[model samples]
Target: MRQQLASTFESLKVRNYRLFASGQVVSLVGRWMQIIAIDWLVLEMSGDSGTALGFVMAIQFLPVLMLSLVGGKLADRYDKRRLLLVANIMWLILSTMLATMVVSGLATLWHIFVFAGLLGVVNALETPVRQSFVSEMVEPKLLPNALALSAATFNAARIIGPAVAGGLIALFGSGTVIAINAVAYLAPLVCLLMMASDQLHRAKTKPTDTRISEGLRYTARRPDLLLPLALMFVIGGLGFNFPITLALLAKTVFNTGPETFGILTTMLAAGALVGALASSKRRERPSSHVVMGAAAMFGILEIVVAFSPTFWAACLLLLPTGFFMIYVAQAANQRVQLGVAPQFRGRVMALYILVFLGSTPVFAPLIGWLGEVVGPRSGLWIGGVAGLLAAITAFAVRCRKRDVQISVNLRPRPQVRLIEPERPTPAEQPA
Candidate 1:
């Protein structure tokens, strides 16, 4: 048990990762709080209009779709730590500006939309750099663990942030929550400043002329990488619009307020946190089968939650939904990061973030419109169907490419297995 525990959290033994994780714990909680506050504020301003809320969400991620590739290239070319420092500083400024506008009663829906766009621009640049920087903080052997723990940190914040934000919003206001997030940015900024540059595992080949197109070509050539990326794009674009979906569900479907919204979001995060920790115990890169299976389960759970008869049932269902959600994501992430060459990590991860997040702009508004038109549950089931289809499609393609055969048997309690293709003997070879 002790050995397992140690392995699960082995990355914390590194000083750089320890500091980074500590700062992230504080910073990510604040970010989640700000997310709750922003969603509530938008709902309040627009009178619970899902379309308006979706528009803001779309604007916030549009820059990621447009500019994340450039950000990835910049990460490959420059110092990642310094790039992160700059990004955090920009986040601080933007959070502060939004807080000031809200506190002074000058904030409007349009102002929030504009700020969301600006924040999106910063995120486009920051996300890939920060993701690639994890490789710098830990050894290659610890990369998978570090990635899982990073996700655990984010989901841990997800568990705490919304609950706290709900209470604060009920007591103080959205402005106060935003201001607190602004202050929270200082934790990461200070941590970055205090990091030991000498301890970093800097990449030996820092290619200054790495093109985004090269990363694309690299991914295209590798079916292993392509499979997960394709699955992520479909599931991520359609299945992961939780903010809008949950918010609309809370307000319109359940006739609840921010506190209920917080609870619902917290339930999802709690399950996600568990999933991340469970993944942290893994030493090897996840298999494609594992990724696909998780995606299928995630899709199935979302569909179940869509038809939940009561608010509490939905919240309860969200727990398993969140687990499969993070599990598939982490599995896909490990698959990509582990398979790619070191030189292309940044640009390829940028493509990962692009598919995972940048596609949000295209889908958020559509989900929101669905929420407005078809009913809130439509958003959930639609995403669920997309995820299920994506998983099935990717799995079939992988099996066909690898000449693998799958068989299922129901006589012995329903078993399924894959059979590897037999290789031809040298005597029978044409050559």
Candidate 2:
């Protein structure tokens, strides 16, 4: 078991990846803290409007849609370590400013919204760079492990950060949580600077390039990637998004406060972390079969969550729901990134981010409206059913595509005369 765990962590053997992962762990925790604090603060400040919550999420995800291509282009063109450092520094400055304003009681809903939009812009620059950076520091075989570890650590932060944020919000306020997040950005900046160039392996950047469109062309041809991307539009955009559901579950179903909501979120994160670890332990890339199965299971479990009679059960269900959901997510990401070549990885990953997150705005309002109409439970029904159908379709498509091939053969033909008798080909052909 110990050896198994060590092998799973083989990616961390690289000093550069180790530093990046460690700092990201710290930074992700801060980010999660801010996420929870902001959600709770919004609920309190605005009387728990579902539309407002969705709108906030829309602002954050909106930029990811518009700039993912540009972000992808940048990731392929520039030094990713430097890009990440700059984004973190920007976040630090913005977070500090927000903290000061909130602490001084000068913060308003519009203030939070505007700052949230700015953070969205920062992530537009950061997400693709961060996603592509791992390959620079690790071998091809080690990449799945690296991505899995990244997801696991990120999920672990989700578990701890929200719970801690809840307590901090209870003890102090959202301002302190924001301040802590600002300070935490320094950890990643330092890690980025400390990463050794010797440990890096960047793809050759073209001094003059038109290859951004080439990445899109490649993805356009790959069914394995295309199908997963399409399903992500369904699952991530419609079924898998948790923010709108979180507000409804907290305010309406559970009748709980921010503290309880945070606990539920933490439990969900714990489940997702477990899923990440389990996926990382596998020796091979999970097939589309695995990805679809996890997605289907996630949808079913979500229904179980909707029908749960009490807050504790709902909290418990969140773990399994998150576990399966993230299992599918990481599997899909690993397949898409690894299946593409190093030269095209940045744009490929950018599309992955866009497909995975870009549709949230379109679906969030629709789902929020469902919550308002038939209730939160009904909204889960839509999510569960749609997600299951998407997964099943993806699975079938991949299975059908297996064993496909085109035959080619080269054989010497009897010398044939051109514009002459078949027997008189000595002069006409290579007799």
Candidate 3:
């Protein structure tokens, strides 16, 4: 057991990764806290209008869809640590502004929207740089372990942060929680400054390319990269709007407040943490089949949660749902990063981010509107169906490609004998 545990956490042995990962854990928890607080705050300000909440969510991610290509180019051209430091400082400033507004009783719905939009801009710059930075922090062979451990850290924070935020919101209001998140941004900033810059494996600098469409062109030439990204677009865009769906579930369907909402998110995060740990322990790289299977399971579980008769039952259902969600997402993440060339890692990963997160702007509001119209359960059904269909489509394409290869092989008539070459005698070898 001890051996297994050590292997799962082996990435921490790298001094740079350890510093980055440790800082991320603290920063992510605070980020999640702010996320929950924002959701609840929107609900409070908008009188539980799912549409309003969706609008807030959409504005936050819209910039990624629009400017992430540029962000990716910048990541490739510049130092990731420096970029991350700037982003963190921006977040700290924004969070402070948000807290001040809320505390001073001047915050309105538009204030939340503006803050979310500005934060989204920071994310557009931060995410792809951070994603690609993992490769530089550890050896190529340990990349999978490092990525998995990062996911584990993220989900573990998801588990604790929302629950704590829920309690804090109940006690101190959203302003105080936002203030705490503002303070949390300093952890990563300090960690970045403390990192041994000389020890980092910096990517070879490439000539700057101002053409934002180059990344899209690169992805178009590689089906391996394209397929996983398509799956991500579907699952991420349509199926991963849990903030809207889960928030509605707590406020509308369950008739509960921040406390119960936190519990629900915490349950989801617990399952995600478990899944991430399992991914970290795997000896082999996760294949596309694994990603598809996890996506299918994620969809099915969302359907189950949709029909759950009680809030507790729904919470229980989300545990497995969360597990498969991260499994699919992280598996796809590993698949892309491992296959991509170093020169294109930033740009390809930016496209990956574009699909995985940029799509959120288009879908969040739709999901929210669905919840507002037919019912909150309707959004879950839509999301689940999208996931299920994405898995099926990927599988069908894989089988078709296999069938085409089999047909060609069957027509070939090579009758070569399969024999091992004679081993060289010991005396025949060069001294």
Local distance difference test values of all predictions, in order: 0.92, 0.82, 0.89
Q: What TM-score does each of the candidates earn?
A: 0.95, 0.90, 0.92
lDDT of 1 by residue, 1-431 (tens): 99988988999999999999999999899999999999999999998999988899999899989999999999899999999999999999999999999999999999999999999999999999999999999999999999999999999999999999999999999999999999999999999999999999997768866999998887787777878888998888889999999998888889988999999999999999999999998777788899999999999999998899999999899999999999999999988888788889999999999999988899999999999999988999999999999999988887687677888988868999878878721221100
* Weakest 10 consecutive residues of candidate 1 by summed lDDT: 422-431
Most accurate candidate by TM-score:
1
Two-way TM-score contest, 1 vs 3, winner: 1
Residue range 138-179, candidate 2, lDDT tens digits: 877788898999999899899989889989999999999999
Ranking by lDDT: 1, 3, 2
RMSD of 1: 3.4
Residue 388 error for model 1, in Å? 0.6
Kindly provide the TM-score of model 2 when superposed on the true structure, using C-alpha atoms: 0.90
- Please give, for residues 201-227, the per-residue lDDT of candidate 3 as tens digits: 886666467355776786787777777
Model 1 / residue 224 / CA error / Å:
0.6
lDDT of model 2 at position 183 = 94
Report how far residue 327 has shifted in candidate 3, in Å. Answer: 0.2
Q: What's the lDDT of the predicted structure labeled candidate 2?
A: 0.82
- Model 3 TM-score on a 0 to 1 scale: 0.92
* Candidate 2 stretches greater than 4 Å from native: 204-211, 396-431
Q: Least lDDT summed over 10 consecutive residues: which range in candidate 3?
A: 422-431
